[model samples]
Target: MTTTAGSRLRALLADGELITAPGVFDGLSAALVARTGFKAGYLTGAGVAVAGYGLPDIGLLTQTEMTERARVVVEALGDVPLIADADTGYGAPMNVVRTLRAYEKAGVAAIQLEDQAFPKKCGHLPDKELISADEFTVKLTAALDARTDPDLLVIARTDARAPLGIDEAIDRANHYAEVGADVIFVEAPENLDEIERIARSVQAPLLINMVQGGLTPDTAPDKLAALGYRIAIHPGALLAPYVLHGLDALGRLGGTMPDVTAGPQGLFELVGLREWSAVGERYRDNTKDGA
Candidate 1:
């Protein structure tokens, strides 16, 4: 049997090297990331909300909306695994079951669930409230139970760092790990000390969220690996650059545009138009021969 993307991701995590999954919000962004030879890609919720709907990440994107986006990105990313963010499992325990089934069917390799209540703000954002450890545990348990594929990672995220404390966040991380979470994410650590502490305290493989200009201090991937984090996701790393360059190009439209000489073909080729064209010709030829 062919190894699934989830199994491949699990095996990669088991081996050495910290998985650096750059965030992608759409199919083309995912294609770009995949083309660069990234082992994994993350479907960032905040990126999806902002880029797709022109909204913020205040739980505004619905479960169906995010799942549909994941499906598209997954299709674009053939063999590459997509670690998706399932915000608060889209609701309570029962809701989490459906959420898990939906995302799994969408071909995501993993689904990250946070402890924040509905209308949850970005983890880097302040004043984020969290459901109790017990309440969050129920959701994590539901997530683990809901996955038919055992290799599908169920990541439990705690947004308690700023609201409660690092101690409370670490405690929740351990609690979620104890409840059978495949990975534990202590969101938005204040500094490197807090990051090291969470990595040391949590029993599960740690996932560090490296949001640019967010609460957590940026640490090198090797340093994070030394601290024992298995995965680091830079959710806004690409979006930030993409938006900045777009604005720069738009501002200079009256003048010479950046990369304008590359032309439309270069843009289409970025998403594999030539490869798709070959596939179309082959299909037509085969159909004609059969007819």
Candidate 2:
């Protein structure tokens, strides 16, 4: 049988230097990322909540919504692997099982589940709490069991660094690895020292989130590879640009604004406004022949 996208991701985990994936928020973003020749892409919770629902990443998006988005992103990328964020597994152990199966059917390469308490907020946000480590282990095991294909990478993320401490986060990561997580993500590590500690501690491949202006500084991919990190997802890198562009466009559209001229006569020109007309023109001959 041909290897599925999930299996391919698992194989990539075992290979060389850290896999660098840019965060993709929509179909257009995913397509653009694939065109950039990156090996993988990440579906960030913050990006999804903000772009899909125009809401904060405060447990507002449902499982169906996220899974549907994953399906769309997977289709858009074609063969490019996708690592999706499944926040707190959307509920309990059973919920984790369902979430896993849904993403699997959607053809996601990997799915990351965090150990945050229910109604979780963004990792960089405050007032975070964690479930009992043992309970989370059960959920991780359930996620592992639910996967029909071993190639489906199950990434366990710990949000305990800020609330519990670095030691606790490392401990939790180790425990999750024991429970069969393919990769360990110690989210929001405070500094280089902590990142080094995580790189040394976790037995499974380590995945790090590098968000600009967030808890972790933006480190170069080569440096992360030198520290033994396996994969690094810059979930907010592309998003920051989109946010800034939108803000600037809104500002320009306000009072005393200068008109911005359109640039280039390529894909943007045709797809921006003339997409339907272009499609009609392409099929116009067929329709005329039928008539």
Candidate 3:
């Protein structure tokens, strides 16, 4: 049998550098990130919820929709590894098995499954409930077994920190590692101390989510690396800025009713469309000449 996608991700994880995987919602965003030279990308459920349905990440999106979106992103990024968020494995142990297979076939490099209960909310969100550690362990095992490729990295995320506490979260992380999770993600560690504590406690590779205006304060990637985190995903960094800037521009244009043709050329000038068109003309001429 051929090496699996899971094994490829594990190889990247073993390299010992903090993989900066920016959250990508669509093919365009994934392509843009790959073009920017990042080695890996993350398919965030929050980004998908906001971009695809204009809804909150409150379990509104279905497993099929998320899997389909991952397929598009994986295709767009080509060989670049993608770590996809499969929230709560979309159900139970059996569900996790299916999710792993789906993501593996879609060419995702890793699949992250959280331990939140059914109809789970985002980790940063409030009023979260968690399944028992033993329950989640079974799901994690299923995820590991379901993967056809050993290289398809299985990231076990514990949302127990907020509801149960940091100690419990660490315990769950240890359990996940025992159950064959390639990486452990202890979500929503509120302070710097907890971050350092989890990094110190968890022996397996760890992944951290850096979200703006969320439970955890914003920290630099270098700072996180210093604490021993192997992967850091900033899912909302680009999306948040784009949302605010787009709204600002829309409000200004709609309120002032400015003449559309009055402003200076923007992206067209930035990209030099005329130059590109001239190059295309040359290519067309070459094709016509059979060169």
Candidate 4:
């Protein structure tokens, strides 16, 4: 049997090199990330809310919406492992069981659950509310127990830095790790000092969120690796540029069409037109032969 993406991610994590995952909201982004030879892709909640649904990342997406999108993105990603965001596990601790199964069934290699209250805002955003650490621990435990595959990572994220303090966020991160979370994420640490402190303080493999124009500084990959960080997810790297360029393209559409280089064929090629055409040809001959 082929090694599952979860198994692959476990191996990658064991290798001790920093795993960098670019955020992918849709199949196109997932395919592009895979094509670019990334180790993994993050199904970013923010990206999905903004790019997929034209909504903000204020916890508006449903479990079904995220899972349905995960299935498409996982298929498009092929062998690449996907680390998906399951905001608050979609509800209470018991709700996490169904959410965990749904995401696992969708073939994501990892599921990230945060400690924010229902209707959670983006980590970088202010006015975020968090459930008690003990409450989140129960949710994390539920997800961990509900996981069918041991290799499927359960990442625990704490959005307490902005609301509580860096010390509280670090404490929550360690507590989650102790409660069977495979990875620990301390979200939106504002400075290099907090970033270093998180790496030093957390007792498990650490994951950091690297958001441009957000609270965290853009730490270099080498520096992060040096700091003993395991995973770095840049959630808006693609979506930000895509949105900006899309706006520019929309503005240009009212005038003469800009010089078109990659027309339909080239764009289709990026999405495996040739491979699909070959499959069509093979089936067409069988259909014509009535076999």
Candidate 5:
């Protein structure tokens, strides 16, 4: 029997291996990560906001928009499991029910829901507020109940470290896991000690987000695995590099770069031109003589 993508991810986590997922914004970035042999990929909301809408991660993306982005990345990734960041489930508890179904339909293996209130900000941001634990539990329960496939992992994240402190954040994470969160994410631990505390305290499978230039330290993946994190997602791995080098590339360019500047076929192949061309050739030369 063939194992499904979600099953693959669940098995990877179960086997005691630390799964590292690179954050990808679109189909091309997804394809790149898939080609590079990463076990999983993350569809990050922050990446989607800046890449798709040129905005900040300030609760601006809609549910439909994020689903569409995940759909495309899922197609690009084929059998690779994608852990999608479904920010705050798009609204209240009822909205979380629908949001879960939509993302499942989009073929994501894991869905992450945070405890931040509506109009959520990025996890690394300061002055962040969180909804009451009871309120978040309702949404988390809704997500757990809404999934038809049991293989789909529902990750519950708490952004209360800066606001409520690490101990409270870990408490919330434990409560979320007790309430049906498949994995626990305590976002933005300030130091190594705090990071270690979250790892040692949380009983369930844990996820660590390594945001470039964010609150978390540049702890190595092996270190994180040793610290008891089962899954590590670098959500801005591509976005941060892109912004930094993109500025330099733009400055160096005397004029607007042409379509075919970098690669042999330019940006066309980046969009799968060769594969698409083969598909087009099949139709264009379907003649009697196989022209």
Candidate 6:
């Protein structure tokens, strides 16, 4: 039997190394991450909302929309395991069950669900509300039971640090792990001290979000690994630069955009024109030879 992508991700986690996953919102981003040879890729909900739907990550996108995008990204990523975000599981515990099945079918190696209330905002943003720890635990347990593949990881995130306190966040993270969350993510630790506290307190393998200019002070991956973090997801590493560079190009216009003249053909090559052309040529030659 083929090794499923979820199995691959599980192996990576067990390897005793820090996995760095870059955010990939579109097929092109996924293709680039795969070609660049990353250990894994993250289908960022914020990236999808901003790039795909031209909206913010305030629970505007539905579970099905994210699932459809996840399918396309997984196809583009080929063998790379993708860790996807399914915010708040789209509703209650039963809702989490359906969301889990949908994402698992989309070939996501891992799915992240947070404790934020419905119509959730980005973790970095303020005014975020969360469901009670007990309530979220039920939703998380339901997600775990709903998965068809045992290798498919379920990451439990807590946004309580902002609204309640870091103590609440840590408590909730440990609670989620106790209920069988594969990974614990304490979202938006405000400083190095809070980050260290979370690393010391959380019992399960930990994941840290490295959002640019966000609430969490940016820490190097090596430093994070030293603090006992297992995964560092840079959700804006690509999208932020892409937007800034596009704005610069727009400002330069006909002036200083570095006119490489690499037009449609170059763009197509980035998305695998050569391999597709070879397949077409092989069929054409066989037809000419009357085989």
Question: Relative to the true structure, how large is the alpha-carbon lDDT of every model?
Answer: 0.85, 0.84, 0.82, 0.87, 0.85, 0.88
Task: Give the lowest summed-lDDT range of ten residues in model 3.
Answer: 261-270
Candidate 6 lowest-lDDT run of ten: 259-268
| Residue lDDT tens for model 1, 67-186 | 999999999888999999998988889999999999999999999999998878778665677899999888899989988999999999999888889899888889889889998888
Which parts of model 1 have CA positions greater than 4 angstroms off?
253-291
- Give the Å shift of residue 62 in candidate 5: 0.5
What tens digits encode model 6's per-residue C-alpha lDDT throughout 165-229?
A: 99889999999999999999999999999999999999999999998878889898889989899
lDDT (C-alpha) at residue 279 in model 1: 69
Residue 192 error, candidate 5, Å: 0.6
Query: Over the stretch 181-220, how does candidate 5's per-residue lDDT look in tens digits?
Result: 8889899898999989998899999999888767788799
- Error (Å) of candidate 3 at residue 84 is 0.4
Pairs with backbone N, CA or C atoms under 3 Å apart (clashes), candidate 4: none
| Weakest 10 consecutive residues of candidate 4 by summed lDDT | 260-269
Clash totals for all candidate models? 0, 0, 8, 0, 0, 0
Per-residue C-alpha lDDT of model 2 across residues 1-291, encoded as one tens digit per residue: 788998777677778768998998799999999998999999988788777776666677899999999999999888999999999999879989999999999999999999998778678766777898998999999999999978889999999999999999999999999888989999999888888888988887899999776778778888899998989998877877776576578788883433322321121222222443355457868899999
- Backbone clashes in candidate 5 total 0
Q: State every prediction's TM-score relative to the real structure.
A: 0.86, 0.86, 0.85, 0.86, 0.86, 0.86
User: Where does candidate 6 stray beyond 4 Å?
Assistant: 254-291
Best by lDDT: 6
